[model samples]
Target: MTLTQRQARMLADMTTPTPTQHAIQVRGLTKSFKDVEVLRGVDLDVPPGSIYALLGSNGAGKTTTIRILATLLRPDGGTAVVNGHDVTTQAHDVRASISLTGQFAAVDEILTGRENLTLVARLRHLPNPGAIADDMLARFSLTDAGNRRAGTYSGGMRRRLDIAMSLVGNPPIVFLDEPTTGLDPQARLEVWAAVRELAARGTTVLLTTQHLDEAEQLADRIAILHEGRILVDGTLAELKQLLPAATVEYVEKQPTLEDVFLTLVGAPTGAPTPTPAKETR
Candidate 1:
């Protein structure tokens, strides 16, 4: 079947109230800004309860694609369906079902963490907002700092609070745009753990990040975007197979020539190294 047809079918299926199924579908999605095309007929599918990572370099349209899916931006062509609702046609419904955390944490600095969660819960019309706020605080390990002003929180702490606020409504679909960009290693791991817990509990996630390792570690499937187009889309194993074979090397010499070459050329360790010369007589 064509990608458009598949997306339509996926949308129809999601509306049926079935327990487990696809949570997002996109096909032939095209977007342009002032004659500069950002999304060139992109197609994607995200299964329910899975983490789907959109991996790309800077200016590759990853953020543009994500904004469209989040219903914050509209595509010039094609369609997208999220959680049984069309992003363009049923924009309000789509917004109601999803939460987004952009590259920067969006939180009210003057408000306390607990207050932020309560505000979001109330906005979502959840009953017993205070109770829901408490639950979110506990889930994100922010209970101890919940009473502190967001402005006083550390970067990692603020990020956790932002994510916790997003979960106030118990959204079934979440979009995290470089959610760990500024986090330290420990904080990044904490965020990853939270993401895993969400997926395990049946929440579908769509994340965009330049961190390939993060995508490799957490994503069930990944799509590489290059120059506003999807260069490849598949599981990590499938994508790895598409690339040239990689090799690992070990040497007895300290501060080897390969390491020096990499330092000067600024290439990753996985890239092939040139042969080194042996001592001459």
Candidate 2:
């Protein structure tokens, strides 16, 4: 899609949603594009103000499910209620309650970061466009680069700005369709921090990612989607309990490449891993 089209769609998500007890509820949701069935029977229950990850491989209907909930596309069968409104019958109400960030950042190359934000605020007919833009820029740690054109931003910075733009109106729930796709490790970490902050502020996040580590890092609850079906849904520990306990064994653990890279680059590390390289060398 062209840049204008993408911006228009993002602006359309700025409507305010009514209060609801549950963030999202779906049952037997199905969709098909011509002969191919994308979603067979999907059931989900997302609690308020939590991060829910939909883990699936490519062509696993993650995006299709998100689109249906966001009211961008119609489902062929079953029901989806987002923020207390049925996705089909109450499409406008559903749209009012959520925002979406697609696989790629949909920012205008020519516009400055601040301009891009203020534009969305103005489109939504908000009260203070400048203040809203400034607040988002600061919230996403883009205050220093707010005046710079978005084309010059790094991958991580662009994604942060994209997410900030999606939050201008404070929609109750956000749909992130592979928000970290194509980002470098550092960039991905930056986006992860931003997502965590969103959940901390009582906003519900429905994240779709193929990266297992990403899901483990961000999601409070995870649902594995495969072949248009939900194989399992639970917390990480609950899912791990499904497997038999490991037999006792003594084995040396090694620092993974990620650890070495993060340490060498001075990026943040969640946990410390042994650095045998220093002693061996």
Could you give candidate 1's per-residue lDDT for residues 1-281 as a string of tens digits? 33456445543443333345569888889999998988888878788889999999999998998899888898999989999999999999999899999999899999999999899888878899999988988887788888989999877778878888887778999999999998865556667877887888889999999998899989998888888877666778766655447875553545565456555655422233444445433
Tens digits of per-residue lDDT, candidate 2, 1-281, equal 33355444433332122345568989899999999999998988898999999999999999999999999899999999999999999999988899999999999979999999999999889999999999999998999999999999999999999999999999999999999999987788889989999999999999999999999999998999999998777778767765556777666667788777777776633333336543232
Each prediction's number of clashing residue pairs: 0, 0
For model 2, what is the error of residue 67's alpha carbon versus the real structure, in angstroms, after optimal superposition? Answer: 0.7
Per-model TM-score versus the true fold: 0.80, 0.88
What is the Cα-based TM-score of model 1?
0.80
Residue 226 lDDT in candidate 2 = 96
